[model samples]
Structures are given as structure tokens and as C-alpha cells.
Target: MTTLRIGNASGFFGDRFSAFAEMVEAGVDVITGDYLAELTMLILARQKAKDPERGYASTFLSQLTEQLHTIAGSQARVVVNAGGMNPAGLAEAIRTAAHEAGLEIPVAHIDGDDLTDRANTLGLGTPLAANAYLGGFGITEALRAGARIVVTGRVTDAALVTGPAAWFHNWAREDYDQLAAAMAAGHVIECGMQATGGNFSFFTEIPDLRRPGFPIAEIEADGSCVITKPAGTSGAVTAETVVSQLLYEVSGARYAGPDATVRLDTITVTDLGDDRVRLDGVRGEAPPPELKVSITEIGGFRQEITAYLTGLDAEAKADLVQAQFAHALELSGLPRPHNMEWTLARTDRADANVQEEASARLSLVARDRDPKTVGRQFANLLVEFALGTVPGFFVAAPPGEASVYGRFRPGKVSQSEPIHRTHHDDETSLTIPAPTEFRGLEPTSLDAHSPAPANGRTSAPAGSQTPAPAHRSGTTDVTLPLGRLFGGRSGDKGGTANIGLWARTEAAWQWLRSELTHDALRRLLPEFADAALDRVELPNLRAVNFVVHGALGEGVAYGARFDPQAKGVAEWLRSRSITVDADIAGSVNLDDFFTAEHTPASASSGSDAAAGES
Candidate 1:
């Protein structure tokens, strides 16, 4: 049996490159790198727009160039999804670096995933808002090319390794089961340092972080792999922490399509001897039909004004300023139709004493169609508001200091764009060109904001993807009625609700938007129903993000971890209705929210809305 001892040099985007050398020294069969994130993608796209030549950093490629010969000589393979938006460009750079390094070793350029161009070509013609998808074929072709190292684009994080193992062992093309097993392996190791201890929840106990060992994957031919830090490393790899990391890998809720998902529960974990855990039994379904499209346009200008408002009776002075600012906004001569929210922040400290500089900071955030018009008006408004007030002055507020915030318009891409892919018919048989003279290229210093570290120990610019590779094979229609959106017994402090819903690409999202924003989904609830949906962020999973602001409406999430109000809101919602199951965390969850109560499994079949009414 060919021992494919896969090693991991880096976990997320920004990590240490020196670990690649350490993995080489440790004698692993292969190495993998993961790099990509939603916010990070925008960040990279912005960088590329600013300077195409500068967007794709040359650090990792240059490092790989220097060690290409050693890695090729050892016959060890390397897999990386370090290719973000510029996969082809990154590969070309790496190839050039390899040629310069005097390493005539094989360099397979693997990448073809850019949904931006095909966003609306595949039967999807909506106002595009956001775009994000994991890679599949990018990883496969890279490894298939037999390059000493394989670099890819925004792989589902798991697809990075799944692509390689499937190609290496020559698993059947439709063998999604084996493919998923490999996907699990990639998911476990993608967060290079996190799998070890960087973001470990139990990090307080982990010792010797300075020389912390990155994550390594021990894969058996059966498609199972155990993720563990290096032996003799300071951190401990327990099932508890690994399980947490596994869940942490899958972020938010939504990805692009089905087949693109990597299910978490499918993994069978068996702790082996020597602090190693053998993970097996990863399963997958088909992929979704549509792709996520992201379009960024110019929003209005925004500036955060932070100043110390110190004076006698600071709280009382701040209150007077707030009242005076409101009065000026009401009559500031400039058009006053613009919406402005002024908040007097209450500082949280051990002592309830008010600070001498207690005052309000105005964060004027506006999103208008025209930046120029808003900027000019904002300049007049800021000065007018300050001039009308008798409490304080800004720490040198200027006219053009207002920064422009980019507004991201998200929608679905055409299904025909082929956003999600695995392996395809190409290899009939190719052979790696024989190793020739290796010429090393000049090494480039890593950018401070580079997502990942030097060689393998780097982090991604956008951190990395949250690992929630569930079954994304088929798209099923789902319609959450107005009632189901409200009510839930959660652990929010003052009755708040943290809700999550899973949907297919059919009319699920559209229907949801209708109910929540357009159709008054919140009106369905009666008691403790006066709540606002604070933030709607799409993290990792191909799911919905609904974080209620005040009532905790039912539970606590990103805003409030465990506020009593949010918990009460969730429980109240649960008591009032039944249909969607709750995935609530914290101490205030109602034990009976998910009892035998369930609504129509198929929402399309019914027209009646089910409410979590108590």
C-alpha cells in the first residue's frame, strides 16, 4: 500500500511559512494549505483592483520555489487552496518562481473557479449581492498534475484534500462517499493552527505556543484521517477540542450549492493510541444548482468620531450634548431627511462610576447612491451639528476625512456557471516531465497582511472559512411562513432570539426575504414580539443569519452570547409555535423546544404558517 502520509504546514490564511520546512523534516507524504474567507475575498478583490501586480503576494510561491527540489525528491505531495480570487495568476507566479529556483520539477496549474463572470449567465438574473463558493476540481487537477505541490482557489476548505486523495488513489468518479471522507480530512486540517491550538477554546491550558506545532493529517487509504498537532507538541488533541474545531470549520450557514457541502455528522471518530484520533466515514450528496454572486458598489461616506469629552459631571454633560445634537439635526439648515442614529454608549466596568469624559461618539454611517453628493452634505452637517452644540468639539474633524464604505449587493449566480466541480475526464494518462535543472527565484518578503504565513504556517488575509460542509447535493424548495420566523425559547438576556434556517436554491431565499423584510414576518408574534433583526451576516454555512437585537426575541448569538432577554424570547417563540428546530447554545435554552413538535417537513405542500406560539 502506498503510504500517503499527508502533512499540513498551515491551517488558515495567515500563518508561519517555516512550518512547511518542519513538515518536510518530519517526513510526511503530502502537505495541504487552506486560504479563503468571505470578507477576505472582498479584501483580496479590493487589493487586486488597486494593483493587479501587487494583489497576488509572492511570498508562499517564492518559499515553495526554494524547496521544490527537496519536496519533489522526497516524492512527497503538497496540496494548497492558497489561490484566492487570483488562482491562475498565483499558479503562474509559482511556476515562474519554480523555474527561477532552478527546479525543473513539474508544476501543475490548477484553477477555474471565478463565479463573478458567470454570476447571471446560468438562469440567475437577480440583483447580485454577495458571492462565495468552495473549490472542487481546482484541488483535483492540481494533485492530478503530479506537481510536487498543488495550489488552488476558494476550495470548500475540505475539497482541497478530497480532490487530491480522490485523484491519487483513483477513486471512482461518482464515489461521493470516498470523496466526502477525504473532504472531512481536509476540513479537519484546513485550519492549520486551529486544528493544533491557535484558536483552540482550551487554549488557556495549551503551553509553549511560540513553537506550537501546526495541524497534521494522518490519512488511511480508507479515506479517513485524524487531525493532530505534532507529537511532543505542547497542545493536547482531545475529542472534545477536535469536535469543536470540526463545527467551527463550517461557518455561518450558506455556501453555494448542494454536492458542494461536507457533512459533519458523517465523520466517525475513533481515538487511536498515542493521542491520535482516527476519523472515517465521511459522506456527501450531490451539489446545489445555483452559484452565489457578489457585486460591490459605492455606498455613502462614513466616519467614526472618537473623542474624550471630559468635564464636570461627564454623564450629564453628554446628555446635554446629545439633546443639543438632536435639536441641531432637526434644524441644521442642511437637508435633514437623512436618517441618523445617535447612541450614548454606557461603558461596562467593574465599578459603576461614570467617567469624567463620559460622552457620546457619533458614528455617522450612511449608504446613499451618490458618494459626492453625500460627502458634501455630510461635511456641512458635521460642522453644523458640532457648532450648534455647546458641550464639545471633535479632535480635528476635516472635510474630506469621511471614508467611503463599499456596499456589497448579493444575489444568486446562474446554475450553468459550473461554480461547484470535482474531478473530470482529463488524465488518460499524463506523465510528469522529468526533473531538470532547478533554478531558484529571488525570495520576496511576505506581506504583513498576507492571509497565510511564509510557506505553510501562514494565515489567510480573510482569516479562513468556517467549516460547515454539510450535504449540499440537491436543492429542495422551502417556504418559511411569517409565523415560523418569530417565537423561540432561547437564552437571550432580555427576550431576544437567535434563529437559523436551512434552505435550498429554488425559491427558499426569495420566499424568506419576502416573509422577513417585505412580508412583515415579525408581525406574527404577539408577546415579546417587539424586536428588531439586528444583523444578518452570512458566515460560512449556506444558511441564513438572523440575529435579533433587543428581545433576544429568543436566544443570544453573535451580538449577545447569552443575554437573559434573548433566551426568554427564544423560549417564548418555541412555546408559541412549532415547525423549525432550534440550534440554540447557552444556559437559557428551553429543553422542550424540539420535542415531538414538528411542522410539515415539506413546506411547499402546505399554505398554513406554523408559529412557535406558546
Candidate 2:
């Protein structure tokens, strides 16, 4: 058996470089560096503005230079997407560094995702904001280029290791079933050393965490890799830890990828060889024909304030006083929230009767696209209820600490823009070169067009607030951030657009009607309201099946389309009152689920599909 040593240095782009060096020192077969975050794409987009040619990402090249000549070739390679928006530039830079070190190494550039060209003018007119996918096959090409250190832009986070392993082992592209198997192995190992106990939280004890080495995946042609950490490290490799991590990182009903909509249920784990567990049974559906780009728009702001409310009968007093304040606010024609997030801290040492004075926070879940509205309303609420029983249950609202939050959606920039996904198949044939001259490379976005220029000193575009005049001649609609709307695509990032959140009862919508424009909805919606909502019998409340004739958004009642009316309806129906939901988020990794399942007492509180709004 050929043994390969692999390691990862940095946890993120802003992480320490010493980790990689330590891994090299520890004799890892390959050094994999993970430096991208869910929000890193936005950061790279910003960086590209300042130096279009340099593009957005430059961390990997600089970091690699720091360890150059010092790193001996024990088959230790650097794989990272710290290249961000500019993988080609980083690849070129790596070659240059190798040349400076007098090494005649071949460098590979896996170029294909900068979808920036169509960003300015695609999809009917709305602009494309951020465009990137775990660029597939690019890493394999880079392996083909003989790159000692490979850098790429937003490739599938897992493929950083899997692709290279596949390329070196010469895995066949025609063999997708096996390719997917290898890809699954990469997915397990992508989070750097996370697979090998570096970040496992269930450990009974940990050792030398400060200098923990990276992970290694000695993947075989059969689609399994030994889940091992660097030698001389203080970590345990067991069946429990790895499986737990796998279960934790993946969640939701669907996991979208460039090639397939993979189902996590297909995965299985077995403790086969000594200290080596076999990972197999990962299956994938063919990828969507159109690539999705996340388009973020200026939504508005949210304000929150925290307060410590403890003493004798804290819950009783908090609940009573909270009611007082809420009643007062309701009378004043203002919204009153139900729950104050209370976190218990410091034990029972300092409380009077309760002996548990937990700190509670009251937050505003605003709908308007204006920060000022949230800021002002929160400030007013704080003053009126800061010290009383009901509303006085919380205080410390951020007076004016309001900032803009971006609302994101998906749209296509191109029809399968050429993406070079590179993976390593074997290690024996890999070689490194002294940096060489790599010029004429320019950073371009795989997205369709340039996002709204952010370099200008202009603040967020002023929001448009057309006074529809409440109780006007329009029906109300609600949009819940379920499924894809919440960025819930596999390997995409966290945030599934609600992907859940539907009423359990059809009649339950009636209780929602006082706050909802059932009358107007009747005119706009033909099937439910306008068509006799009173008689519309709902099943499990899985979905409203709004036959609004013209409601929902536009003529897109059939498909997911956005019309001004739909936007208005969405904003209208999101919420007419302040409420808190239960956290139904499953045990599958870090995905989110709506917590409030008890609205009308007839809903199941959970739906697998994404709903428009509650």
C-alpha cells in the first residue's frame, strides 16, 4: 500500500499560516488549507473592485511564499480556495514564486467560474450579485498542469482534496458513479482537519490544540479514505467522532451541487481496517441545467436590546410585566413581541427569590427595507417598557445600533458557464516547480455582471416606500424564507429559505385573516379567498395552494417568479403581529428551522417544502 501524508494549515483565510508549516513538519502527505467562509464570497467581490486585474483573492499566494524553499517535498501540497474570486491570479503567482526559488515546477490554472460578465445584464434585468460554485474539474486540470501548490476560486469545499486525489489516481470522468463516490470522500474531509478530530466537540479530553496538525485522506480507488490526523497530535480517531461531524455538517431535505442533488441518506460508514473507516453509498441526482447565482438586495435593519431581569419570582414578574407593556404597545397601535430570549448565566449566586436572574433580550423582526423604522420603533418601545412588568422584561436596545442586512435570492447568470473542476488522482506523478512567469492573467467573475459598485461613498440605495395606504385595494401576501430562498442548496452555504413553515390547518388561515387582508386576497386570489376562502378546506396545511388568480407575486403563481404585486403581498403577509416560533432545526449540521409551530393549533409546524410566507 502506498502511504500518503496530507495536512491542512489554516482554518479560514484569516487563520494562522503556522498550522500548514506544522503539518508539513508532521509529515502529512498533502497540506490542504481551508480559508473560505459562507460570507467570504461577498468579501472577495469587494476586493475585486479595487484591483480588477489582481481580482479579489490574494491570500494563498502570499501565504505560500512565506513557507517556500523551507518546505521540503515529502509530497506535501497546498490546496486552498483562498484565491477567492481570483484563482488564476493565485495560480500564476504560485508559479512565479516557484520560479524565484529556482524550481522548474509546472503550475495549473483551473479557470472557469468568474461569472461577472453577465452580472451587469442578465435575467430580464435584475442584476446578478455573487456568482460562484465549488468550481468542479478545475482542480483536476490544475493537477494535469503539474501544479505543486493548487489554488482555486470557490470550488466545492470538499473537492479541494477529493479532486486532487481523483486526478492523481487518474479517476475517469466518464465514471460519475465512482467520481461521486470519490467526491463524497472529499466532502467528509473538506473541512480540513475537522474530519480527523481537530474540531470534534465530543472529546473526553484534548491535547496540544494550539498546534494541532491538519487532516489526511488516503483515498483509495474504491471511494474511501483513512480518516487520520497528523502524527504526534493529541486527538482520537473513532467511529463516533467522524460520523457525528458528518451528520452535523450536512442538513435539510436537499443537498444541491454542480453535478447532482445529493441525498445524505445514501451515506453509510463502517469501521473496516484498523484506524480506518470506510465511507461509501453517497448518491447524487443530475445538477440543475441552470447555475444559480445569489442576488442580494438592500433589505433594511433589525434592532435588539438585552436586559437582565432576575429576582424573586422572575418568570412570573417577567411574564406579568411583559403583558403590561405589550398591552400598552397594542393600545398605542404598536407591535408587541412575545418572548425575550433569556439565557441563564452565573448560576444562583446573585438572585433574590428566583436565584436565577437570567438575562433576556427583546428584538424587533422588522419587514420594511428601512433601518430608521426599526431603530425608531425599538427606541420608543425600550423607553416605554424598560422598567415595567410586561414590556419592562427587557432593556438595552441598541439605541441606534442599526445596520443594513442584505436579502439574497438565486437567479442564473449563464447556462452552464465553463468551469474547470480539477482533482488529484494519485501522488506518485505529482511534481513542484520553482516559480515561473505567469503574466496576462486577469481576474474576472464567473457571475453574469458587475454587482452594484460598492467602492463609491454612497450609502445603501435609498429604499422606496410607496404608500399603498394600509387597508387599500390590494391583497396581502407573505413570503417565508424557506428552501432555496434562504440559500439552501447543497454545499452552497447555510440558510434554507424556510424550506419549512406552513400552517397545519386551512381554517387556521382565518385566524390569520384579521391581520390578513382576506377580503382583498379574495379579489386577488381566486381559489382560496376571492373564490370562497371560507369554504376552502385545507389538508395538513402543508401549503396554502393559493389560487390567488393574480396574488403570490405576479403571473408566477405556477412557478417561483417575482412581480411587484408578489413582493407587496410577501411584505404584507410575512407578519402582521409580533410572534416567536419554535426552533424546529433538525440535528443535521447547522441548517435552520422555524421554531414557531403553534399558531392556530391545527398546523404540524413542519413542512419539507419552502412556503411563500406564513
Candidate 3:
């Protein structure tokens, strides 16, 4: 078989519950699901602590129960990272479910990613859950041993697709280019509907996003693939959708993974009609010597209250409440919280139609190691001022007890440190060997002033010589939202946030490359003015990406910012108004930029094809 059809069902732990059945019925050769995130690991750790056999994703079993017969009757195989922290345990549950369903399905599982017990010994601090990322070979071993269903604990998300591709194609470790292509394809579909139309920036352009279908990758033996979805599905796949997902949560050009490092700048996206996008020419390099490990631990307890200040004197009301609350806490004999953050949002209007429109919000968040410091005692203290405080002062809701929050930190372990093992259905174990050859990747850094080569390769080697910015002369400019001519995608990577902006046409690309510099970005998003920012250009895709360091103080679970995951950061950037060349803006049809099948003639030239050529 030269091509394999792999469909993704789940993006995160709580994704659509019916996606599994939907994909299985769509007639794909394989089905894969991803159910882990930094926050998810912490949740699973808590579950396992309560009951040892409950660490894995229980939703996977429920979905399997409903689709076991349909899957057993078809040639399609199932693979997922739903095994989470307990692949062995989930595998056992799957076997029991198969027996109860009167189906003789063979189940296999890959393990040895968990490193919580040996964390301290390895010089990694004690964490609630510590798992090293493994590669695809272990999944290959299980499939080759005749297992129809495979489960793994903490493998790279791409491994779900790359393993199946490797098994069907019989690829060797040395085939870096092929592996890299598969890795790129995997990354695109791994987030399920995000590749279809869900969370898309230009959602208004998509005809029907009511119920977006999960994405499917048609992978060929050579590693290139076409991204599409089930026929007649609600969502439509276009070049813009694929491009958005390709840039989601990524940093720099070298996308390092356990299997191989993919050159993000090398991939080319072509829009094929009827909701299909082809991704080709992706290049890959040797796997890094170290595997990334996610270490999650309980940070502390936190409690918060949001009070509404209605009508006049909003700022003065806010100040008075803060003073009263502090004095009251001192009188109550309760120790002050270690950290107290107050934010007063001036959302009130001077002459509004309703009370809600004329009210501002005052939010106070308290965090401390002692639960009592931020628990019922804290709530009682805050409520005491409800009657004695400023007029028209009432909280959004009654204060609740403190809840524990988790902290996520990244660690690294030697590729050989974790024993990659696969347990077969026939009660046998196989140990997969680590890659003997290793390559160290240089830290990625790009100079914004460096011009992209004519062939369109925008990535430069680290510490490369820099040149002064090229000054271009006069053009008619118009002020509008950046979204008028561009689409953006943003996501969180631990504490850092990445925003990727792409233009639909070469003319827009030319304007974007000259404009939107690092200083220009600081002026647009003042929140990151003092934060360290790294900008990378991908001219082949007509795109530029920015990474904002420390944007999220300690990752999602820490709740450092209002939008903890930073999913909307790109949309925020696109909403900013900027002056752009009127000719470039006129060349793009704002309504058709994302919906059209082909690039507009006015925007692209014959030279566009050679932009990224080597």
C-alpha cells in the first residue's frame, strides 16, 4: 500500500466525545487521538494519587465501548496517547473491554516514559508527574507484532501518525527526510478540528463551522501528504487553515522532536480544490540526543473574587474597597496572603443604557501555600465588607474555597536514559533500541534586519552576520486592521506565547516583510513592550512568526494572565490597526482571502513560485 489514511479524533482530553465514532465511520485506514497537555498531566496525577488504576484517560475506554464492533469489523487500526501516565493499566482495561464485548481484539501498549520515581535520582526535582517524550519505533514494534490497537504513555503527539507510517512503509531511522515529512503531517492533524476550522482566525470566511469535522492525513510512502476531512463535513479545508495549524504553538524553524527535527521553513502548502491542501517538500534532520521531559507539580492554593463597581467614581470605588479589605483582614487576625493581585477593569460607560454596561470589574486574586490563607477564611473576610463597603458594591458570585494549582517545567534526559518498551498481546515484551547516531541542534536565533534570499528561504543560521534594514521609498498607505490582508494563529508553549501572521499574496508578503518589525510589534502590543521577543520569517509561506518570552509567567496551570493559554494572542495582534501600502491592500479581497481557492491575480506574480526554492 503506497498511501495510508489516518484520521484524528481528539485534540485534547475533553475534546468532542463523538469524534471517535465519526472518524471510524469515515472509512480511514487508521484512527489516532491525542489527550494530553501540560495541565492534563497534572490532572491525571491527581487521579492516580486517588486510585492507582485510574491515571489514564477514561473517556477513551467509553469511546472504545461504543465503537469496538465497528472497529473490529474494519481494517482500520486505533492508536492514541490516551494512555497518558499509565499505558499498561489502560491496555489492561482495553483487553477487559474487548473480552466483555465478545471481540477478540489484540491490544498492545508502549511504556517506560514515566520517570516520577527516578526524578530526584536523575537530579530532576520531585514532581507530581514526570514523563519523558519517546519516539515512534516502539509503536512500530507493537504493530509489527500483530497488535491492532496500540496505546502509549507520553509519546510525542506526532508519534501516533509517524509510527503507523513507519510500520506500513518499513522506514528506517536513517530516512530523516521521510520521517520529517510524516512529522509535519502529524503536527497538522494532531490538533483535530483546529486543522479543519475550529478556532480559526478567519472563521467568518468558512461557510459552515457549526460542527467542524476532524482532519485526515493521506500519507504516501515518500512522506508527503494531503490534509483533508470527511466528505460533506461541516468545515472546509483550505490553504489558510493548513497554514494556521502548521504555525500553531511552534517556535523557530527547527521544530525538534524525539524522532526527527523538521525544517518548518522548507514545507510548501498548495490548496487543492474540494477541501484538500497538499503539504510537500518538508525536510528533516537527525534526532536530538536529549528527549524533553514535562515535570508538573502543585504550585500552591489560589482563590479569587470579581466584584462589580456600578456607576460613578469607578477608580475611587476600587481604591476604597482595597483599603477597607486590607484593614478588615488585619482586624480579623488572619495572616495576609503571600501574593495578592488586584486588577480593576474600566469597562463602564459614562452614559450607558443598562446597569451592566455602566459597571466596571474589580478582581482580586490571592495565592499562598497555606490553604486556610486563601480558603473559607479568606472568603468570609471578603464577604464581611459586602454591607459596609462602597455603594453598589457586589461580587459577581459568592466567593469559593481555594483550589490547588499546578506548575509546569520542562526538563531534559538523555535519549538512552528511558527504556523504550512495548508489551505485546501474547504476554511478551520487546525493548526498542535508542538511536546510535545523534545530532546537536544549535539554539535558533534570527536577525530581523536580514533580508530573505531571492529563493525565499528566510531562516538564517544562529549567530549569522546581520545587516542594516533596507529602506524602501514612498507608497500610498491606508490604515486598517492587520487582519484585512493577513491571517494569524497564536498558541502557548509553556510560559512563552507564539503568534504567527501570514499573508495571502506575494504583494502583501512584500509589505509585511518590510513592515511589522520587532519595534513595530512592541508599539502594537504594549503588554509585551518590555518582554523579550524573537521574530522569524518564512517567506515561502508568506508568513512571519513572533515568540513572546515570559508572556505567561509559569504556564497555563499557573493562571499568570487572564488568557492563561494565550490562544487569542494572535487575534489580538491581527486586531491592531496599521498603515499598509494601499496597492497591496487593494490587491487582496478581504472576504475572499481565506475562502478563495487560488491566489488573486493582482497580488501574486510568476516569481512567487520561486520564493522558497533552494
Candidate 4:
């Protein structure tokens, strides 16, 4: 069977710049980059509004410039979604960069994904930018037609991998199984270091995490691939790592794409040793008729403030600060905000060496439609409480003005709408064919079983549970942070967020699935106690994923919460102490898991690391 080696260089817009050169030097048949995230579309739309000729990722040009000789000298082909809202603009930039490097690389671009014209008619608020997700065949066609570089806008990230794989294998559109397997492979590698131990809940197990190597997929003709990183790199590619990325940002069992729908529940992963994990058994079905449409509009204005409280009565200090800020807002004659976020982060240490060690943080965020109301009202209120706050109180930094950005919305458009166009160059163009068979198909709905009906609890399959320890008759129990026994990863899906938690041992898995019910999750994090949550089990991976509906109020970008994207939701849950069998707890190190850096719900200096916010 023929094997194709594919490497991922860039995960998102601001990923490590050195990854491209590193992947090129590693010598792969195909190199792919994923830069267009849901939030990135809004950013690119604003950029395009400012310059007619620029909307794509300019960093791509720099990557080409730095590794031109390595790329041109090798036989590897490049496919990337750095085009953002403008593939033509990005393609042109790549050509210019190539010329500057004394080389003329033929670059082809895929378009027609932009749905701004049709979006105007939807009347779903003002459309800042609208794009339908494209598939991989267009890229395959471009590569088959001898285009060394293929740039695209708003295509599903997996297309970057599947397109080249389909071309290399000469597979037809109906090769759904192979395509689905390729899609799984692409999903695993699309996020670069994510599949190679970055953002992993069990990150402590991976060595040298400070500088983990990017991922590469060694895909075989049988649709099975071994995920591994470059030699001598920092990270491990174990089954746990692959499973973490597999469940990230995903909802339900079926993961929808333009070309084929992947049955994530049917997928399997196995450790192949030597820093490689094999992925296979991915089933496929016809895709949904509609392409996911992302539209961003003028959401509103948002402002936030961080205050530090030190010494003995940390909680009391936070309480006083929160009350004073609210009173200040009312006294300043500002209208009540549409949504207000007041989060208290406790970071108090028992034996403190510094003032920060014995302090907590109170974060205040306000959002409103009126930009002036949010911006000026917040600025004036913060100054009022500067003198009235508790003793030893301090602002993290000088307050900044509110920011006005686009709000994200997810919708769908008919696949047959002829909304996409592909450009091989200025002279050649082709229309991307929409799926003919599966039009207007509704996706399979996820199912949940409640174990404790009175508490609105969900039950996992009995077969999914691991058997109790055979040698012991009775179980001893201990209380410890959930991170000691389980690893988790979380991400946002517009207004929804998913957190996938897994156990390192069978004993732990049984304890986790039984004890961590939806109600239990609510008890751990009261902020979303009333919010609807759905849980499902992946027994093979010993993992459970919880979907929180309406977690991100209007949308991720417009959400009022400090952690709008819900990236830190799982970590926060893991930090909570849980009662587990003493046998399972004995295997984990409690001290390392409970560090000052991992202090429960603690505020940071100005920066919101949890939200990835400035």
C-alpha cells in the first residue's frame, strides 16, 4: 500500500512562525496550514473593509519567504486556508513573496465560499462577512492540474489534508470510507501541536512541553494513519493525546463536513509505540445538504476591570469590591448593562511569601448595544470605586477603553446554491460542485440517558463501565482534584461549548462516569447550574464529553463572560476536588496537580489567560 506523509505547519493565524520551516525541513510529501477559525473570519472581514486588496493572512507570505528554497527544492505540495476572506489576495501575496525569493511558484486559489451577497438577504442583523464552508476536491483538482501552491478561504479545515490525500490516492468522490478516515486524520493534525500534547489535560506526562514539535500524519493507502512528530521534538503522540484533540470542539457522535459526515463514535485509536498513535475505524455517511454559514455583525461594546484583593479576608474583600463597583455604576447615572459579569477568583495561599500569594481577583465585565454606554460608563464607574474599595485593594493595571468588534452567528445555506467558485489563477476558474444526493438532510440528533431521574442525571452504558478491582472486596476512598485522575479538553461551538474528560485508568473511568453526573457538574460550577447540559460516553477512549448549550450568550465573540469561548471551563471543573476510590487516587500525585499557577479561579495581572484575552 502506498503511504503519504503529510505535515501541519500552522494551526491558527498567530501560531509559531518557525513551524513551517521545521515541517519543510522534516521532508513531507504535502504541507498544510489551517488559519481560518470562526473568530478569524470577523477579523479578516474588518481588515478587508479597510483595504480592498487585503483580507487574507499576511503571515503566510512571510512563511513562504522564509522557507522558499526548502519548499521549492522539495517535491512537497502546499495547501493552506490562510486565504481567510480573500484567497485571491493571499494567492497574489504568495506569488510576490516567491518572486522576492528568486522563484516563481504557480499558486492556485479556491473561492466561491464567500456568501456575502446571499447573506444580505437573510436579514440576520447586519452582515459583516458571510462564508460557506467548502470541501477538499477543489484543492485536489488544483494540485492535479499542477498548481504547486493551493490557497483557499473558508474551507473546512480537514479539507487541507483530505484534498492532497485524495489526489495522491486517485480516489473518487464516492470513496466515503477513505475520505472519512482522511478527514479524521486531518482533524487530528489540523491544530498542529494540539495532537502532539499541547493543551492536554495530562500535560504533565508529556516531556519537555515548553517547546512541543508540530504534528505529522503518516497516512497509508488503507485509510489508517500514524500520528507522530519530528525526531528529537518535545511532546508525545500517545492515544490519550490523540483522543484529546479528537473530542475538542466536537458535539454529538456525528461530526458534519461538506464532503462526508464522520461517525466519531465509531472511530478508534491505538498506540503504535515510538511516539505514534494509529487512527482507524472511522465510518462515513452522506453530508448534510446545507453548508455551515458564519456571519459576523456589529455585536455591541464590552469593557472589563480586574481588581486585586490581598491579606486575611480575601473573600470578604472581593465581596466589598463587587458591591462598590455596582453602586458606582448606578451613581454615575449609567443605564443598566444588558449583561454583567462579576467573577471572583480566589488565589489565597495558606503560607504566603508575597502579597499576590494571599490574594483573590474580582473581574467585572459589562456589555451593551450602545458603544458610548459601555465604554464611558465603565471608565467612570471604575474611578469611583478606586477610593472606596476594601483595604489593600489595587487595580491590576490602568483601565483601558472598551472595544467594539463583530459578533459571531452560525447559520446554514443550501449546498446546491452555486455559492462557491475556484480560481486556478487570473486566467482559469471553476465552480465547486455541491453535493447532489444528500440535500436537505437533517443531521442525527445526539441521545442522552439519565441515571438519576430526580436529579436530572445521565447514565452511561453498563458495558461502558470498567469492572471493579478484582483483588479488593471493598473500595477505600479519598478526596482530590479531578485532574489527578482525569484529563480533559474544551472548546467553543458558537453559543455552545464542549468539555471532554477522560481517565488514565479503568478504576478512575468507572469512578468518573458514576460520580460526575450533570448535577454534580452543576454543583462544581454553580455559574451554569441551571444551564442545560448533555453528556455522552466514548467507552473505547474511556472519555466523556459534556455539551453546555447557550453557554456563550449571543455568541463566543459577543458573550459577556470573561472566558467567552469556554476554553477554561473544563480546567476549572478539573480543579475542583472530588471523592474517588483510594486505590485510584493513590496512582495520582496531588501536590503537582495543585500548584499556585493552577490555583482555583484566581485572577491574573490584567491578562485573562483563561479567555486568551488581553
Best by TM-score: 3
Q: Which regions of candidate 3 deviate over 4 angstroms?
A: 443-475, 589-614
| Model 1 lDDT tens row, 1-614 | 55356777766456677877777777776777665544345556667667665344345675576577788678787777666666557766766766776665555544435555554564334321234454455455556655566665554666667666766677654555666666666766776665565544335555556566767776666677776766776655544345434544232222112234434324445445354666665544344444444444334454433334544454665666557645665675544434344443443233345743344443343333455434655555556566555555563355554455444433443344433432212323222221122112111121011121224221222222212212234633232232233221122212334453322221333333333330122433332234444322221111233444443311111122223333233223323322221221111222211112311133211111101100
TM-scores, each model vs. reference: 0.61, 0.58, 0.92, 0.87
Residue 149 alpha-carbon offset, candidate 1, angstroms: 3.0
State in Å the error of residue 436, model 1.
40
310-362, model 3: which lDDT tens digit per residue? Answer: 99999999999999888888898898899999999888999999999999999
Q: RMSD per prediction, one decimal?
A: 15.4, 16.4, 5.8, 8.5
On the 0 to 100 scale, the lDDT of residue 301 in model 3 is 93
The 0-to-1 C-alpha lDDT of every candidate, in the order given, reads 0.46, 0.45, 0.84, 0.77
Model 3 TM-score (2 dp): 0.92
lDDT of 2: 0.45
Error of 1 at 95 (Å): 2.1
For model 3, what is the alpha-carbon lDDT of residue 444?
42
Distance from true location, Cα of 315 in model 4, Å: 4.9
- Winning model by lDDT: 3
